[model samples]
Target: MSTTTLTPKITMAQAINTALRDAMTADDRVVVFGEDVGPLGGVFRVTDGLTASFGEDRCFDTPLAESGIVGMAIGMAMNGMRPVIEMQFDAFAFPAFEQIVSHVAKMANRTRGKVRLPMVIRVPYAGGVGGVEHHCDSSEAYYAHTPGLLVVTPATNADAYGLLRAAIDSPDPVIFLEPKKQYFSKEEVDVTAPVPPIGRAVVRREGRDATLITYGPSVPVALAAAEQAAAEGRDVGVVDVRSIVPFDDETVCAAVRATGRAVVVAEAPGFASVASEIAARVTERCFHHLEAPVRRVTGFDIPFPAPKLERHQLPGVDRILDAVDDLQWEES
Candidate 1:
């Protein structure tokens, strides 16, 4: 007799919810709170069923004040509590910039390690969700540029579960950027399974012609571009950059060196953005092995546009493919 063990399939949002539930169950110190996170279950419903499962004391709601919410989390962290707070949307987090950069990001160093903030700031980020202004934004570059903060963004459902669990358990503060567009994307996931430690980049596809390095919302676009390139007789690889800060130099450089060509993709603008940093690193580390200058396919340098116009602002498959083609290729 043959038996089939079926693995449950779930969306990224559900996977994240499962992670939160598990974390709260394991540790009494793990508390979750933010705007509408309690009774409303969050805007994307990623925190759904938390209040019922963990109760109001562990998973409650906060006011609309982003700064106050983060400030409270910092105080809670300093007092030995692990607070996982949410910023309802990407641009909505800007109001808490002072609190994040001033206190949350610098508290440990300022205290000479006497106080550690084991906190996770979850920001639902990136475009392609047709959200109005202040609803969608690619703000990873801002947090990644700051020191003393671990910045990570997951592109897959399995990662959505694992990364959040790791972030909650971390001793330092972590900026967890969730790709808003991928929240509903489903896949088979085992929430209890082990995952790679934070800061490791995973190669999604293998190719010899060129490589597409990307993260978050742009990851799917990069993979689709790779598939299209394969149809055109051009083999292309893809690297999913799960962690922004503490970048995986070894893995990223290795993939670029193997292909000898690379294009960095992101929904953020190219000017001095995360995509720019990746392109620079690839160029510097893989210079001798590179056949052409690193290219970037990124969102235009402008404010997050209206919902109807986000398509042009977010990186897409065609733009990524064009960047791949720009990589100088020798005649076959």
Candidate 2:
């Protein structure tokens, strides 16, 4: 006789909530605080019930000042606490940029390794849920560009739980970008399951003709485009670049080299963006293997537009397919 273990099907938001609860339960040093995070349970309720489970001292709300919230987290981290603070929204995090860059990022290095800041700054980012101006923005590039910080984002529900747990465990500070658009997306996940650590990338689909490399919210879009390309007789692969800071060059270059054609897809603008960096890296490492120049399917170089005009700025399935078509395929 054999027994079967079952995993619970959960949304990305719930997975995040579970991660927080488990982390707090395991470590008394772990705390959760942000705007509307306590009694209100956050704007998306990702922090819902955390306050109820941990009580006010462990899970409480803060004022609307983003800088103060981050500053306080930094102070707590320096004093040996693992803080997981939320920024409320992607754009709202700008006000705390100084604290992140000057203090949180540079603390350990500035102390010559005498200090380690175990902290996670959570930012709900990217467009898709018809959010207004300050709510939807892809700000990963800024954190990725900064040194001494581990920048990571999750594309699926399991990753949402796993990555958050890993971030909470890190001794170095982390910029945890949660794709708000995928918050409600569901998947069967075991909260106790181990996932790839930070600084690794995973290939979501495998193929030989071409590769679509993306992360966060664009992972689903790339997968959809790969499916459509399959129907059209083109075998395209998809790579989810889960970590932006410590990019997995081995996995990404391998995928592009295998196909000899590639397109970098992202929700941020193409200019001087993470997409641009990946394309350049592929060219630098896999230049001889390339059958064509690497293409990019990314958002326009403008502020995130209103809900009505967002689709025009975001990379979509049709746009990704068009980019794959431009990869200089031989005429049959």
Candidate 3:
């Protein structure tokens, strides 16, 4: 069955709310709970109306303890219930790191595949809204480094709805990172269509000059930069890597090979990050077809800065275009 129905144009937050509603209706065992998720409707109101519609039993609020919330979700999943828990903010989820890595991530393996840790950890990540400290951290690389977690970030309203439903239905734990910057962005979507499953990359724009690979908040930056490059007589492509962990290597490699040049973009720092992994993989897969070395446009290797300095810290469209310009397209 499809995860969506005919619905009016909505924002990413509303689309996600719709997915939560749909998931709970499809599966009675699906439950949603977290700090402020019940009556307050989550920090971004993504869980708004869930409690009123599904009742307290299905949608409720937990204490301010992140570890406890995740630990409880693990127990619930082990006992056969599907729990969807939310971390109020990106850096706020740090308190639950221990439970996530030690228990939630290892439950299925410890149970020898006999039990499935069917849970979804929703985190509102990335910057652009000028949030305070600890509110806009791009910690996706940390979770992606964890062995048992499936990390995914959606760039469009459709994936925001579809992928959340897919994550809730998965048999294992999933780290669903929503780009907070895109929460209010609106788009027309056909709710009746089934979106691609997790681990697939979608090419938002097609071009042969070069490929601009990005995800989450960086997707829009990459697309805009591609457009700017087009006006400059460079036909650049944009690839949104919806899933980070089980990355769509086939699609990424194909696009890079076709273009002969690539630039990866992400909001995370430039250390051992998702962008680093992608650049490395593209270099390995498309070495023969490359016109220049793969470039990465990412955040600085320092802590997330304050609101005023965020523009300088985060990678913007001009920065992405700078990386594209750095690509030595003249090579044979």
The lDDT for every candidate, in the order shown, is 0.90, 0.92, 0.91
Model 1 over residues 1-332: C-alpha lDDT tens digits?
11242247788899899889989999999999999999889989989989998899999998799999999999999888999999999899999999999999899999999998999999999887888768888888889999989999999988888999999999999999999888998888866477558889999999898989999888888899999999999999999999997799999999999989999999898899999999999888899998889999998999989599878888888888888887777542
lDDT of 3 by residue, 70-145 (tens): 9999999988899999999999999999999998778788889987799999999999999987788999998998
Error of 2 at 72 (Å): 0.5
Q: Against the correct fold, how does model 1 do in TM-score?
A: 0.97
For candidate 3, give the lDDT.
0.91
lDDT of 2 by residue, 1-332 (tens): 11133256778889899999999999999999989999888898999999988999999998889999999998998888999999999999999999999988899999999988999999999999999878899998889888889999999888998999999999999999999999888887766576569999999999999999999999999999999999999999999999998999999999999999999999998899999999999999999999899999999999899699999999999999999999888742
Native-to-model Cα distance after best TM-score fit, residue 182 in candidate 2, in Å: 0.6
Off by over 4 Å in 1: 1-7
The superposed Cα distance between candidate 3 and the true structure at residue 242, in angstroms, equals: 0.3
